[model samples]
Target: MSIARARLAVIIVSYCNADDVDRCLRSLARSDLDQFEVLICENGGEAAYTNLLARLVGPDRILKRISNDSDVLDLPQKRLASVASCRFQARANVVRIGLAIDNLGYGGGVNAWLEPLLSVPDWDAVLVLNPDTEVDPRALSELVAKSAAGYGMVGGNLVFDASPDKIINYGLHWSRMTGRVIAIGRNAPVGSTPSAENLAKIDAISGACVLATRACVEDVGLMAEDYFLYMEDLDWGLRRGKHRIGIADKAVVRHIGGTTIGSAVTIEKRSDLSIYLSARNSILYARRFAGWRWICHFGIGLLYAARYLIRGSSSAGKVALAGLLDGVNGKTGRPKVVPGAR
Candidate 1:
């Protein structure tokens, strides 16, 4: 399919981040792409959704002034008025918002929003994006262009929101020997001179912003629900056998990493939830794909715990150890409390 004719749907799963959702919607309103639809799955319940609506559609007019045409989308009748449509010349594009009754985690929230759209044949591709991201004007267009060229999955260059000049992730590199997943182009400075090597095939793309064709989703399936948050993208990528994964260098996104889950900059400040999930899911992913190499993955978890203990981060150490044990014991889903919390 050609870029102009291809139908695109963007899904953003947000949890308790009204400001971030507002910013993301505003950025989408300014996109260079002629037409597309956006769905914001607010997983923080009715309160967060109310705050988000105020920010996006309030008298302040944070989003661009756009006409809401009734026939733009055949959304559920109850929330049809909530869908924002922009009249760009003769074409009407849509922006729909919905609320989850509870916190559904990242993957569950996305699936909840996406399951309804799967029956609609209008969209040719879906872009799953984080609320804590701002896409460049050309980002969606470039991603769609790659999808048209037959790449099943595609990602944009991701830069830190605070340090836009520095690259945070181009994609991911997974190692079978050590059962490790590493972000490519991490902390690399964006050079004044552009390099052809910027575009390449990658093992996996960051879940923060990725585009997938309808055909790919049908074949490989949706994001795994086993991982409440972390490693779900990696698992999806691994399952997409032999399908090409492309990194579009021109498509840039500024991401506020760990906005919902705590910062990685400081050990103490890191959220117990983030540390626990990362440790638990890494082991689960390895067991699913690495065969006998799963032992190495378990050992890596031990190393993380040991390092945390050595650094006097007892809480983080305890969280990691607890996560490792849970994964070994085949435990999954959200924990009742913060792992290792008394």
Candidate 2:
């Protein structure tokens, strides 16, 4: 089926960041695409986001009951006359807001919405977008176009929300040999373009804004739920078999990197939770994919911990060490909250 004619479903998982979700929904309201649906899986937040969203998208547009399913709440559809007409408009799009009963981690939250969608065969593509992101109006369209062009999974270029002109990642490259996951264009200026050869293919796409075909998801399976937070994207890509992954540079998303867990400004300022999960997940990823080469993975982790300690990040080093040990012992799920963290 042609992507343009095919139905699209966008799933955004949110955790206690109502304001960020508001901004993200407003941006999506401006999408140039004619037809699509947004399924927002709200993972435990104290604020009454349903009411907040009603105000943003209008109460009349908010649906009371979507289905018998306890997990999903489908929002009402309000026709949008034009983009210049209002701040929030449901338009021709169907918006389903699913309030998760608990605080499911990233992958788990996504699966909350994804599982139900998978049962229905109408969708051609599914876009997993981060809540703390404001996508370019053309972003989804570009991603869909790429999916229709035969790419199994396609990701958009992500730029820092604070410094919109600085590139965060074009795509990701994971080296199984060294157990390293590198962001292709970490700190390059936004306008700088890569050579065609460099843009030809990528090892993995950022989970920040990934678009995948139904076929890809069916083949690769859902995002690894075991990875509660990080490295799930690389795992999904690696498991794609012979499917090609590509980046749509024309599709750009402004992302607030750590709105829920990490530092909003830079990766260098990652929080304890971010550090712990990343450290643990890296080990888990290697163990699952690398087999006997897991020893090399452990060595690389030791080097990482040493670098953190040498750089005077004692907390980072300590958490990383604890995480590595926990992963080796097969511990998983949300880590205990670091003291004094709100």
The candidate maximizing lDDT is 1
lDDT string, candidate 1, 77-134, tens digits: 2322234333222334556676765677788777765676676566788999999999
TM-score between candidate 1 and the true structure: 0.88
Task: List ranges where model 1 is wrong by over 4 Å.
Answer: 1-6, 63-92, 189-201
lDDT of each: 0.76, 0.73
lDDT score at residue 103, model 1, on the 0-100 scale: 71
Indicate which candidate wins on TM-score. Answer: 1
Please write out the lDDT profile of model 2 over residues 27-88, one tens digit for every residue. 88788876677777766643544554554454554223222222222322121111111223
| After superposition, candidate 2 runs with Cα above 4 Å error | 1-6, 45-90, 189-201, 264-268, 337-342
What lDDT does model 1 reach? 0.76
lDDT of 1 at 145: 96
